[model samples]
Target: MWELFLTGVDAVMSVQIMILIVLGVAVGIVFGAVPGLTAVMAIALCLPLTYALGPAAGLSLLVALFVGATSGALISAILLKIPGTPSSVATTFDGGPMMEKGEGVKALGAGVVFSFLGTIASIIALMTIAPLLAKVALRFGPHEYFAIAVFSLTLIATLSTGSMVKGLFAGTLGFAFATVGIAPVDAIRRFTFDEPNLNSGFDMLVVLIGIFAISEVIKVAESVRSGKNAAIGSVSMKSIKGFGFSMKEFFGQIPNATRSALIGIGIGILPGIGAGTSNIVSYIVAKKRSKYPEKFGTGVLDGVVASETANNAGIGGAMIPLLTLGIPGDAVTAILLGGFMIHGIQPGPMLFISQGALVYTIFVALIVSAVLMLLLEFYGLRIFIKLLAVPKHILLPIILVLCVVGAFGLSSRVFDVWTILLFGLIGYGFVKGGIPPAPFIIGFILGPMAETNLRRGLMLSDGNFVGFLTNPISGAFLLLAVLSVAWHVVGSLRARKNASTELAQA
Candidate 1:
């Protein structure tokens, strides 16, 4: 253990690697501070570049990017009404209102502090539990994996913030997209359209850019004439320092942070729900548990802390399944798993025992990334907040061009360019219809995992309807999905009844 720690420490101590880690954090903060851009897209853009570096450096870059991007999201959520990522959705509840109330610095400080703590807690949890979890996960065969995947997708669709029908449609579209080019089972070409470039389906990064970055461009263009989408406030050093809630008030919110972190981590370890949905869930949980629940949605720090802490901690929660079982728990980890492949490391129980040193290095890397994110975000606020000052007219076009370049660079194919535009339009349609994009992205990312597993599980059981229930692992996941759906339904009904009562009194 001491030897592994020293080796990992040595790797981090290299000047070049430290520079790279810091660079990744800077880039991630910028990406994350922008609405409609996310950690998945940032990591994807950086992946091609990482292909040239050593395992430690490459992993450091990607992990730093992930940590920075995830943490960076609170910036936009606070300053702008929209969250930079789904994970920041809860942050927006308090953050946007607080910014409106001219308390941007307070919201930002609380968010950053809690986000750091949440991340640290998650890493500690990972250090302790990932190995044991992986050993149990290794017992899962293809059938169980497929079942688990199916359960995850179903839970996502049911839990997503819109009509179940639309969620299902999105999942179907994603599953259909996954089926294109070639069959995963037999290398059978299915929907290649004979264009020769479609044989690999969609590169994850290309899809990410399309669904996120390009979609934002399209939305921005649609609003170009109206000019109603102006940013609400700017982040300044003054804003950062003035974010004072009493230390006592912050201490009082400790339960909110801890509970939200646990919830975020719990939801994260579960497949399909994704960070976006987790934030929404955490926000609701915090509001419900707060002594002054009425303060929720009224520019309170508790809301910001709840959302930021959970979503950030989620990075750790999601890694549990990915590192231990080789099954990606979410989109970012799915991409991180790609990094593991490039290093010729297979994840599972064997990964824990065989690559103990590397595993610890990766764990240590998460801690390093968090520290770097903290330092850069605090000291470098002036540099990043300046981005919001860029006129939308100039910034929009540049981002559009970057989106185009990013999409094309995914596989160096024109088809992906078309794919980006197509998804951009689809995403625009959703926005126009008030369908939240978070669930759609979650559904799309989880589609393949869900589809493949369900098919495999059913085939393994000879089409027995009871198969999911017969397997303990599959049964547990399916059960959770059922309970989640039921709980949401009950909650919604109660909310509607309360609203009706308030209207009657008015």
Candidate 2:
């Protein structure tokens, strides 16, 4: 094993592989910094370029891009208050506020540093316990998946910033939208309304662009129309040195960052759920565990730490299943599986035996890419901040154009563009009505998973509902889901009671 590892390290040290890693990371950062673009798009566009290279070099480039793209999202999330990718949605909750508070540099620094730590931590896990983790993931069945989805759905309560009722409503609305496509098992079309576009449902990317990006553009336009300052905000680099944070502060967040990394790894190992879900889940857990939960969305370093750490850590986590079981952990890995296949390499239990040196090459490449990502972002922090200096009128139009391009680029359909416009209006309405969009996104992503698995679990159990309870893993999650709702209800009741008592005393 030591010999193979050393050989892999040597292979990655070559100039050709090193140059590809740098180029891939640079391109990935650009894609992720753009609001409408994403890592998936970056990988897809550059995948063809890899066909001309060797297996080790090609996979190395893809791995580097994955690392860079996941970390780069924090840039736009902090600077523009728009998530550069779905993985960064939770980032905007605090990152935007931090930018407004003139803590942009600090937020970016925390994001960058923790991203490196998170990736390193996961890579260690990938190197040591990948096979063990993959075996554990194999234990999951439809029942367990359904229970997990239920538990995740209940977490929307934690995201309810202003009103729980509004949050629940938004989540339900998102689920309803998700139901627009064909029903999972029955293969029956319910909400197509005789339109072909609605048959496949709205793309998640399009929805994100519409809700966050387009709604933001609309909000800015409204602010300008109302004679308010149209400029988003400004950040300063003066007198700020070394990540704009203290060692004490970094030490303070060690526990939070560690816990968030674990959450990211656990979630990333699951098929379908990737960094997109883990980042938000990690943020919610961080807020819940914080000494002062109220301080979370108020421009704190903890928020950025939790988000960036989990999402990037997911890079290594996602690879575990892909390498050990030949299963794709998420969309990016699904594409990566294709990259593996194209190179005549199959990833599975025998992969380590069949291609020991190549496997280690990927591991080594991941580490190099992580280091490059840290260095690049460290130096590029100011350049990201400079984006804020661009005039809103000019910047927003460019963003809108990119959003359209990204939407149309999905399936080369104009309907997706229209979908963005429609959802943008809905999102604008959400903003006007004091509803948080995060819960809606969560619901949209998980609702279908829960529903499909529920149906499958029932079928497997011969139409017996008791099967869900019989499975210990599923039962435990379901119980926790119930407890989560009850806990929130109890907390809300107590707060109201206290308010009433104070009023009576007054």
Candidate 3:
């Protein structure tokens, strides 16, 4: 193992490979920091480019892109209150608040540093326990998957944090939207409305851009119309130094970072679920475990650390299933699977025996890419701060144009652009109604997974719904889902009662 590892290190240490890693990380950061553009899109665009390069160099480039893109999401989430990707949604909760408090540097630095640490932790786990983890993942059948989705959906309550009723409404609405396309099993069109465009349903990217980016543009426009300066807060480069926090502060986040990284890795190992879920789940876990949970969304480094660490750690966890079982963990890894096939390399148990050196080389590249991402983002911190100084009126228009371009770029269809516009209006309405967008996004993403698995589980059991309860794993997850929803409901009621009692006393 050591000899093969050294051979892998030697392969990636070449100047060409190193340069590609750096270049890929830079490009990925640009993609991830931009609204509507994502790491998946970045990898898809670059997929064909790798056809000419050697497998090691090409795969390494993709790895760097994945790492950089996952971490880069913090930039926009903190600075603009727009998440660059779905995975960074939770980052906005505290990161935006931190930026508002002039702690933008601290938020950005914590995000960057924790992201690197998370990736490193996951890589170590992948290298040491991939096969074992893959074996466990194989035990998950449709029943288990359906149960997992149910549990994940229940998290909508936790995500609401403001109004559980509004959160449930938004999540249910998202599930309804997800059902607009043809049924996964029956292939029957439900809500196409005789329009070809609706057949494919709404693209997740379009929804995300509409909810976060276009709505933000509308808000800024409203401010401009009212003759009030768009207040994004002030950022001074002079006030920021050395990642904007003391060493003691970094050490304090170690526990949160470790836990978040573990959550990321666990989520990544599960097929289909990705960093999008992990980051949110980790944030919730951190908030629940913190002694000062009330300070979570009010500009805390702990929130930033939890979100960034888990999402980036998910990159390594995602690789475990992809390499060991020939199964893609998420959309990004699905594209990576295509990259492997293009290179005539089939990834599975035999892959290690057939290409041990190449496997180790990829691992080495991932670790090196993590370090490079940290260094690059750290040095470029000042430049990112300057972005806050850009006039909102001018900066927002550029962002609006990019949003349009990104919408169109999804499938090169004008329909998607319209989708973005429509969702933007809906998102604006949601905001007015006090409905949280996080649960909606989560519901939309997980609805199909839940439905598909449920249907498949039923079919496998010959329509026996009892199997869901009979399987230990499935039963356990379902019970947890019930407990999670109940816990939130009780908490909400208690808080409401307390507020009413206080008001009456006053």
Candidate 4:
């Protein structure tokens, strides 16, 4: 195993492989830091480019994109008071405050460092644990898969920042959208709107880009309308020193970071929840356990660390299911499915046995990509911070063009372009109505998989609904989902009661 790892490391260090890793990280960071562009969009648009590269090269491209994109989210989260990715939304909890306080460089530095460490830690864990985990995942049948999906869907409350009703609606819409296309089991089609495109349902990436990116453009336009072009805060290494590693601070946060990473990896390795939801899970736990919870949104490094680390850890965690079981843990991994297929490789058990070397190579590449992320963010911090000055009017127009290009670029067809525009309007409406967008993307991405598995599970049990609870793993997940909802409902009630009590006392 040691020799194989060394071999993989040697292979990753080759000039071509190294160049691809750097190039992919650079591209992903740029895409991820920008509101309208995303890591999935970057990889999806670049899938064609990978066709000419070797297996290791292609894996390097995708993994580097994943690593860089997850971390790059913090750039916009800090500088723009907008999350570059859903995963970075939590960063805005404190990151925006830091940026507003002119400590933007320190926040960026803290985020970049922790994000790199998270990636490195998760990559090491993935390399060590995937083979063992694969053996266990092999035991999952359709019912278990259904259970996992349920467990993942329960995260909607966790993902929703302000309102549960809106989050549920977004999540439900996603599940409903998944019901589009031909049914996975009986091949029956539902909700196609009789349009051929609807037959395949909405592409989650399109939905993600539309919801986060397109809605952002509309929001930016409004900000510009208000004549709000907050001066770009200057970022520098000198200003970043305050956030440097400290033993006391490090010990205090070790548990939070570790637990958050574990949470992120677990959610990320799940089939549907993905990093978008995973980061928030980490942040909530970190904040809940924080010695100074009230200090979380107050421009603190701990908040930045908790979020940035978990999201990066999620990248490595999401890869486990994709590489081991051919099950994509998220939309980004789903696109990676295409990348692997383009290289004539299958992603199941055989992937490990037949392509062990390549898997190891990808793992090595992720570690290298993590290092590159740190280096780039540390030195190029000013470039992203400067985005704050481009004037909202100019940036919004560029965003509009980029959205069109990104969507159309997926298929080189105008149909996808229109899809982006339509969804963009939907996203804008969702935001305007105070709806949370995270669950919608989650639902869209998991829709087909959930639908297919639901049908398969039914068929396996001759359409017996009770079969869902007959299996231990499936039963456990179902119980957890129910308990999760119950917990949230109770917590909401208590918080309301407490607020009322305080109001009465006052």
Candidate 5:
């Protein structure tokens, strides 16, 4: 083990490898900070470029990009109240408010520092516990997967944060969207309307651009028309020296950061659920556990810590399942699976045995990438703040153009562009209806997984529905899902009761 570790260290220590890692991190930050672009797109674009490099160098670049992109999302989330990636959605909750309060430097600093810590923590866990975690993940069958998906969907209760009915409606709408293409099991088309483009269904990228980027543009347009553009606020380009926080505050956030990182790692190890879910889940958990839960959405550092930490940690956690089990945890890692196969590297137990040094080298590269991401983002902080100075009227139109370009870039289909515009309008309607888009996005991402797995589980059990309960893992997850919904109901009832009592007294 020691010899292989040393060999791995030597491989990544080369000047060329170091340069690639830095370059990749820089490029990834740019992509992630820009609305409508994401780490998945960055990795996809760089895929062909990897063909010209050595396997170690190519993979290292991708790893660096992954680290940088995840961390880079905080830039837009804080400065513009727009999440650069879905994973940064929770970050926008508190981060945007912090920026409005002229604490942009502090928010960005905390996000960057915690992101580094979270990535490092997850990498350490991946290095030490990957094989064991992979073994555990192997036990998950179709029934278990379906149950997990159900439980994940129930998290919409936590994300709703406003109206449960609206949340459920939005989530159900997402599920309906997911079913537009061919049926998973029967391969029968459902809602194609004779359009060849609908055969493949709506691209996730198109949906994301439409919901986030295009809708944001529409909202900005409305604000401009109403002459309330001042609500968007301005960024304070405050000079921050170190991390822009007192040592006491840093110590205070340690527990939240640790818990969030662990959640990220656990979720990352699970297939299907990615940092996008982890960030929100972690933020919810942190808020529920905090002494001042009421301050969560009001620009608290705790919220930023939980969000940034978990999403970045998820990168390492995601790598664990990908490398050890050959299962991609999320979309970016799915692309990475192709990167591995392209280099003739098949990830699994045997791959580890066959290429111990190479695997270790990749691990080392991940750690290096985390450190590089921190340094790069820290130095580039001022530049990102400068971007906030761009007027909303000008900036939003640019973002709208980027959204169109990004949607069109997906498969180069005009149909996807139309999809973006359609979803943009739908998202705008959702906003007007006071429905949170987070639950909808989550439902859209997880709906197909749940449907496919449920069908597969039933088929495996020979149409015996009881088998889902008979399986211990599946039963446990299903029970948890039910309890989650029940808990939400109980909380809602208690709140309403309290409100009624207060009204009567008044």
Candidate 6:
């Protein structure tokens, strides 16, 4: 192992590999910091360019981009109160609040630092116990996957702020929209309305950009119409040092960061599920475990730590299954699997033996990219904050244009542009109606996973509904989901009872 490590270090230390790593990280950060662009989009666009490069160099570049893009999400999540990527959704909950409190620098610093830690943690896992974990992941059947999806969907209740009914409604609406595409197994179209564009269903990017970016633009337009100042409030950066956080505070968050990283890794090891889910789940777990749960969305560092750490850690977690089992863990890794195939490389149990040097090169490149991400984000924090100085009227229009371009670029379909517009209006309506958007996003992502797996699981069990409960892993998760609902119901009843008692006494 030491010899292979040294071989990898030697291969990746070449100037060509080093340069590609730097370039990829830089470009990835740009993509991740911008709304409407994602690491998947970045990798997809740049994938063709890698054909000219060697397998090791090309994989290095892609891995670097993956690392930087994942970490870069925190910038927009903090500065603009919008998640630049789906993985950063939970970051906006606390990061937006921190920015409002003039602690934008602190939020960015914590995000960057914890992101580095999370990536490093996962890298260590990949290096040491990847095969072991991959074997464990293989035990997850369709039943287990459905259970996991259902369990994750239940977390939307935790994300709901005020009205559970509205939250569930938003979640159900998102699931309904997901159903617009073709049915998974039967291949029968449901809600396409004879439009060719609807056959493929709504793209996640379109939905995200519409709900977050376009809706934000509309909200700002409303403020401008009302003659309210359309500028983001100024944030102070003076006298800030070393990631804008204290060592004491850093030490305090070690447990939270560790737990979040573990969650990210676990989620990433599962095929189909990705950091997009892990970040939000981590935030919920952090809040549940927090001594100050009430402060989660109110500009707390713990929330940022939980979110950033988990999402970035997923990079390594996603890689574990991809490399050891030839299974792509998430959408980004699925694309990465293509990159490997394009280079005439196949990943599986034999990959480590057949391409040990290249594998180590990837490991080295990941470490280098992580370090670069930390350095670049730290230096770039000032530049990111400068965007806050741009008047919202001016800045928002540029963002709006980017969102349109991004939506149109997905498949070059004008219908997607229209889809974004429609969803944008719907999102704006959601704001006006006191509905939370997070639950909707959760439902949109998890509902399909649950549905597809439920169908498959039932088929595998000869249409027996009891099959899901017979599997220990699936049964455990389902029980947890039920317990979660029951706990919340009991809590609500107690709260109403207490309120009634107070009213009677008065």
The 0-to-1 C-alpha lDDT of every candidate, in the order given, reads 0.76, 0.81, 0.80, 0.76, 0.80, 0.81
Model 2: residue 376 alpha-carbon error in angstroms: 1.7
Lowest lDDT sum, 10 consecutive residues, model 6, at 225-234
Q: Which pairs clash (backbone N, Cα, C closer than 3 Å) in model 6?
A: none
For the record, the alpha-carbon RMSD of candidate 6 to the native fold, in angstroms, is 7.0
How badly does each model clash, as a count of residue pairs? 4, 0, 0, 0, 0, 0
Spell out the clash pairs found in candidate 1: 105-239, 105-243, 106-243, 146-453
lDDT of 1 by residue, 216-330 (tens): 7777776666765545586556533333557887888899889988888888887656577677788999888878899999999889888888888888888887788676666
Give the per-residue lDDT of model 6 (tens digit) for 427-474: 899999998776676577667778999999999999998999989999
Best by TM-score: 1
Alpha carbon lDDT at 326, candidate 4: 70
Prediction 3 global C-alpha lDDT:
0.80
- Candidate 4 residue lDDT tens string, 142-195: 898787766666665444555776777787887887787777757777888778
Q: Please, what is the TM-score per model?
A: 0.82, 0.65, 0.65, 0.78, 0.69, 0.64
Residue 253 in model 2: shift from native, Å?
9.5
User: TM-score: which is higher, 2 or 3?
Assistant: 3
Model 1 TM-score (2 dp): 0.82
- lDDT string for model 3 (308-399, tens) is 99999899898986787565556577557757866889776667778888899999999999999998876775554454345557766776
Query: Model 4, stretches more than 4 Å misplaced?
Result: 1-11, 31-56, 73-111, 157-159, 197-199, 235-311, 321-358, 385-388, 395-402, 409-412, 503-506
What is the lDDT, from 0 to 100, of the residue 442 in candidate 5?
60
- Pairs of colliding residues, candidate 2: none
